[model samples]
Structures are given as C-alpha cells and as structure tokens.
Target: MESKELINKSAKKIWQKWSIAIRITPLIILLALLKILTHYLGWEVLELNALFTSLVAGTIFLIGFLISGVLSDYKESEKLPSEISASMKSLVDDTYTIYKTKNTLTALEFIEFQKMFCNSLINWFYKKEKTKVILKKISEMNHFFIELDKEGVQAGYIIKMKNEQNNLRKMILRIDTIRDTNFVDSAYTILEAMGFLIGCCLLIIKIEPFYASLFFTLVVTFLIAYMFLLIKDLDNPFDYSSNGESGTEVSLKPIHDLRKLLIDFI
Candidate 1:
C-alpha cells in the first residue's frame, strides 16, 4: 500500500508537471488502441492501404511543423525576459544620470517613478493582479515628466527621457502579451488529432506481422508522448523546473542584480 501510494504521488507530480499537454493524452490513447485493434483484426484492403500511406505522410509533416513552431516560441519566451531586464536597467541608469547632473529636484521626483517601475516588475514576477495598478502608476509618471518639461528641463534631456519611458512601456507590454499568449495553437491540436488517427490507420493497413505492429505501436506511442511533454516543457521557459544537472532553468538573476543596483543608486 505504501508503494502504491508512492507511485500515485509520483504520477500526480508528473501529471501536474505536464498538465499543459493533458488534452492530447486522450487522443494518444485512442491512437494506441486503434493500432492494437488493427493488429488484432489483420485487415487487408487496397483502398485502406492508399489512405493509410497518405495519412502517415501527412502526420509526419504536421509533427515536423508543430515541433518547429514550439521551438520558435520557446526561444522567444526565453529571450524576452532578459530583454525586459536589460531595458529596465538602462532606464534606471538613465534616471540616475539625470539625477546627478541636471536637476536634483527633478531627479528626486524621478526616484518615485523608478520605485514604482521596479515595484511593477517585482509584482509582475509574483502577483499578476498588480499589473493594472502598476500601469496606472506608470501613466502618472508620464504626467510627472510633463511637469519636469514645464519646469524648463532641457529639451534634449526631456526627449531622451521620453524615449526611454516609451521603450520601457513597449517592453513591458510585449512581456505581458507573451505571458498571456498560448504557445500551442488550435491548429497544432487539430493536426495532432489527425496524426494520431493516421498513425492508427497506417498500423492496421501496412504492417503485416502482428508482433512487429505491436512493437512499433508501443514505440510510436512512447515517442509521441515524449514529444508532447518536450513541447509542454519548452512552451513556458519561465515556468520550467525540470532541468536535471546543468541547471538550465531560466534565471531571474538579472532582476535580482538590478534590485541591488537600485538599492545602491537610490
């Protein structure tokens, strides 16, 4: 009973880890069952042969396309967070320079903006509810900048500050959009269904040896499951926690370092 409990616990952990791809499991099971049925029945027909062959080819192509799409999305997810952190650092540095060189009072006002911006980013890392609040504060920061302009801040410096603010806003919006976007599209799901159906058809019509068909079916099913899990893991690079030895999980070190920089500068 203890062993069974342990197994169940382990399985639950795995299920939670791969839950993003849970929708595909039923289709995979259906395909496996169909493959097994085809072997058991030993159906041989010319029309079925042509249909199965075509389907097998299409399934392979679809899988390839889906893999490429998933990989591209994974790379983008991994890249965007670092890009945001870098942009934030640049904005902070620019604010510090303005504080030191031009106007101490304006710089002091900008410190409030800096704190709000950093708080927004930290909130984004922890709680999504703070996003709206942070965005509102960012709008208020813009008005503060307008006030600085009215106070006869140099035109060139104001332009630079405005450009930095705009860049930060764009980067934050991109991060928000990417976080909310689904990595796996509807077309990928549809293609996966078609692939499974086709795999079953191919197993039934083409493979003559029952043992060979069974072996291939098991291999194919395992490969398909592994592929789905791989895609799921890569889909959200920020959330992936399964790196084995090399510790390849996406790092928030940039944010931490920036926090330190802010403390020192402020």
Candidate 2:
C-alpha cells in the first residue's frame, strides 16, 4: 500500500473516534481561568476597568471561536471528494467517453491511456482505501470489458459488468452516509450560539454595576464552552461528516499502478 493511503486511513480512523469535548473543552476552561485571574488581580477593578475587561475577554473568546470554526471546515474538507469539483468532473467525463466508445487502438496506447487515468485518480484521491476498493471493482469491469472487446463479444461479459456495477454502486452509496449529531455536539452548538448572542447584547447595552454585566458575560463564556465541544464533535468527517460514507479513506493508486502493469505486456 502507498503512504498516502495509510495516512488517509489513519486520518479516517482517528476522525471516527474524535470527541469534541476532549479536544476543545480544555481551551475553554483555560479562558475561564484567565478571566478569574483578571478579577483576582484587580485587572478588572482598575479605573474604567469594566470596559477594558470586556474588550480583552471578548477578543480572547472571539479568537477561540474562530479557531473552532476553522477546524470544523477542515474536517469537512477531508470528507468531500476532489472529484466533486466541476473541472475535475469535466475531465473524468472526457476520459470516460474513450471507454464508452468502440475504437481501434494499439495495445500500448490503450495501456497508456489507462495508466494516465489511473494516475490522475490516484492524485485525486490522495491514496485512500475506499478509492482503492472502487478501483479494484473498476479493474474487474475493465478486464472483462477488454475480453468482450477482443476477438468476439460475449453476452456473459455484460452480466459480469452489470454485477460489478452493482457492487460499485453499493460502494458509492456507502460514501453518502452521514452521521447524526450525538447530544454533545447538538447541545454544545446551541449553547455557544446563545452565549455569543447574549454576550453581544449585554455588551451593547452597557448594563451597569459591572456585576450584572459580569453575570451576563459569564453566560457568553458558557456558550464558548459549548461551542468548543461542538467544534470537536464536528471536526471529523468520517463519523461526523454529512454522510456515514464520507469519512472512509479511499485511494486510486492501485488502479493507476495496475494500468501501468498492462504497459509491460506491450
């Protein structure tokens, strides 16, 4: 197996087990501790200190929230297919036409085209097992198709391709599975959004005595805590991605290499 395949597989497995609270909670706790320290150190008690305190704390929380958002996006990117892009789809469609058509080719040219397509897919998939599995089925179909295209066309090859197509279709369906949110993620996101909104409201209103404002500010902090956990939960695409099938690692390297092997025959 290629190194890229191993990396993707490992990433998928690790992503599957990711716990948002475990990864994100500590940071929230640390921020809370910093706030407490400021209060004890008279940092929040100095002249006109309430305004300064809010600004500093708000800045910290905002940065942490942004980081969480970035991580969420990262996980999503891992789950999606590069082929989902329009340009790549066009490229694949172009090559697929070659296979769809009946044409005369020197054995070497067929093998060359096959190898190139395989290589392109390999780069596209970044060497994941799900892609590997897809390639294997495609190879089986291609081989049978070649046999049928040889000296005589056979009816059985159609049956074989159809069977292979079914198998491939199942694999494609698996890629569509998206996991549901466990309580932690759902609750956390809800809490964080509430906190952000409440905190903004309190700040804008300038609630006096500082204590009342502080209490509301704490609400915002709590929301950050929840968001931290939610981000952790949503960061892995395999289990947490849009589909259950999204998180699996897939690679097209084997198909590319297999196509290269055909060139040896020429």
Question: Considering summed lDDT, which 10 consecutive residues are worst modelled in model 1?
Answer: 240-249
User: What tens-digit string does per-residue lDDT give for candidate 2 at 1-266?
Assistant: 69999999888667645543345556555655655555556555334346656764664566466556646545554434432232223323333443455342422344454455455444434334355555564565465356545734344534544554454445344443332233245544654565555444444443456566566556556556555544443543434222333323232334444545544533
Write down the RMSD of candidate 2 (Cα, Å). 12.5
Count of clashing residue pairs in every prediction? 0, 13
TM-score of each: 0.64, 0.34
lDDT of residue 96 for candidate 1: 70
Q: Name the runs in model 2 displaced over 4 angstroms.
A: 1-33, 41-118, 126-150, 173-188, 194-266
On a 0 to 100 scale, what is the lDDT of residue 5 in model 2? 100
Clashing pairs in 1: none
Where does candidate 2 have its weakest 10-residue lDDT segment?
83-92
Quantify all predictions' global Cα lDDT against the true fold. 0.63, 0.47
User: What is the overall TM-score of model 1 with all chains considered together?
Assistant: 0.64
